[model samples]
Target: MLELLSFGDQGWGDEMLLAGLMTILVSLSSVCLGLLIGVILASFKLSKSRILKLIAEVYTTVVRGVPELLVIYLLFFGGSSAVMYFAKMFGYDGYIELNAFTIGTFAVGAISGAYSTEVIRGAILAVPKGQFEVGETLGMSKFQMNLRIIFPQVARLALPGIGNVWQITLKDTSLISVTALVEIMRQAKVAAASEHEPFVFYTTAIVLYLLITTGSNKFFNRAEKKFSKGFVIEEST
Candidate 1:
């Protein structure tokens, strides 16, 4: 086992390590994209327009209801075709390949965005309407009010939910192995098959996942504390 994990051509360590880093990169990219999509979806859901609300509801429902693996498969297969079709429309020809990394990241990010929409929308609503009124009274414009008051408080309120979403997003990247992006799970599978050491490689994958989760949990915990630091309630006279 030690020899298997050694850092050289005889060992699978270097491949596995690079794959682990790929997993982190993919997960982080997905989370960032998801957060942006979530904001847009939440805005739609919170809007007064019934059509916008319906659009948001339909999107969240469809994405969340489908199994994640199925989503990845659809994107992996369909995304390429769709891109090529568009290309052909513009007088371009030949196959335009969609890389596994792009497909996996987008697929997982779409699912993550669905859940994050609710978390962020709820966080926005959790902030008291009176705060907006106070901002208006203080002569703050709408953009200023949102930037100075709404966004900060909403972020604090949404931190825990976003942290949970991050955990879910990280684990979901394992499903991307089907797309052949070669994240941790993919590398482990390859190593196990090549070396006939399933137990060692699989266990290593589990340990790597745990380390990521633990580190992320600590980071979020510190973020929560930082955001909550100045929060205090005074006793009414």
Candidate 2:
């Protein structure tokens, strides 16, 4: 077991470490993209246009309805073809390729965005209508209001939900192995298969994942506290 974790060519410790970092990088990028896309979708849902609202609703519904594995498969195969076609349109299609990193990030982001749309929309709705009136009375522009008032409250309200999304995104990264992205789970599987020590490699992978989840929980807790400070809530006896 110890030999399997050693730094020599026989061991996969370094590969697993690098894969863990790649997992983190993919998840982070996915979360960022998801947040942006979710915000846009949420805004569209909240918009006055019926067409825009329907479009956003259909997007979230379709995405959430499908299995995540299918989403990754679709993106992995279709994304490359789409890129190549676009390159051809520009008269430069010599096998336009997207790296595994891009594919993994986007596939996870697409899934994350579906969930994040609900979280953000609910958070936005939680804000009091009176706040918007107050902003209007203060001569605040829509952008200014969102920047100064709505965004902070949405961040606070969405933090817990977003944390859940982060956890899901992290776990979903395991699916990226199909795209040939060498994440921790893939590395562990390879090591276990090669070394015939499934227990050792799998156990190590679980511990590493647990460590990441625990550390992320701590950061989320700190953020929650920072945001909730100075706001008093009535406790029911």
Candidate 3:
């Protein structure tokens, strides 16, 4: 049993490790893109414009309401047609091919973004309004206020929620298997089928996922501690 997982062609260990790396890379890319999407959506949701708010609402509602696997499938199967349609408008008629990796990244990012949107918006709202009022009273520009006071507080408050989003993003990458991206889960499936060792491969995959999540948890905990050190309120006797 151990020989099956040994390195090189005789074993699937190297391939499994490579697939694990791919999984981490895809998850990281999705999380980064998701954070960007979240920031934009949160801004829209908090904006004064009714149209922006409506758009944000619809996006979050749809993404969050749908099962993540369906989202990945839709992006994988429908993405090419959608891209080709836009390409035709710009004098390009040929098919616009989107690889499985791109589709997986995008689908996971969109789902992660919906959750992140709420986290960021809540963080923004959690900031005391008086901080902004004080900034204005002191004649500080909006940019300065956001930089010096608002964003820092938001980051600190949003850390835990962002960590949750990261965890979701990591797990959601598994759904990308439908797109044939060959990440950890897909790799495990292949190895299991080939070696007739479903239990071993599947258990290995589970352990790898736990390692990633556990490491992420520690990282986020440290980040939360770092950000939480911003202000100190001392009592006078």
lDDT of 3 by residue, 1-237 (tens): 888788998998898889889999999999888989999999999999999999999999999998998888888989999989899999998868899888989999999999999999999999999999999999999999999989988988899899999999999999898788999999999999998999999998998899899999999988877777756523447
> Considering TM-score, where higher is better, how would the candidates rank from best to worst?
2, 1, 3
**Could you arrange the candidates by lDDT from highest to lowest?**
1, 3, 2
How far out, in Å, is residue 68 in model 3?
A: 0.8
Q: Relative to the true structure, how large is the alpha-carbon lDDT of every model?
A: 0.93, 0.91, 0.92
lDDT of each residue in 1-237, candidate 2, tens digit only: 687797768787888788788888999999999999999999999999999999999999999999999999999999999888888999995987899999999999999998999999999999999999989999999999989988999999899899999999999999998888888888898888988899998888898888889989999989888889998733549
* Residue range with the least summed lDDT across 10 consecutive positions in model 1: 227-236
Range of the 10 consecutive residues with the lowest summed lDDT in candidate 3:
227-236
Q: How many clashes in each structure? A: 0, 0, 0
Question: Quick one: best lDDT, which candidate?
Answer: 1
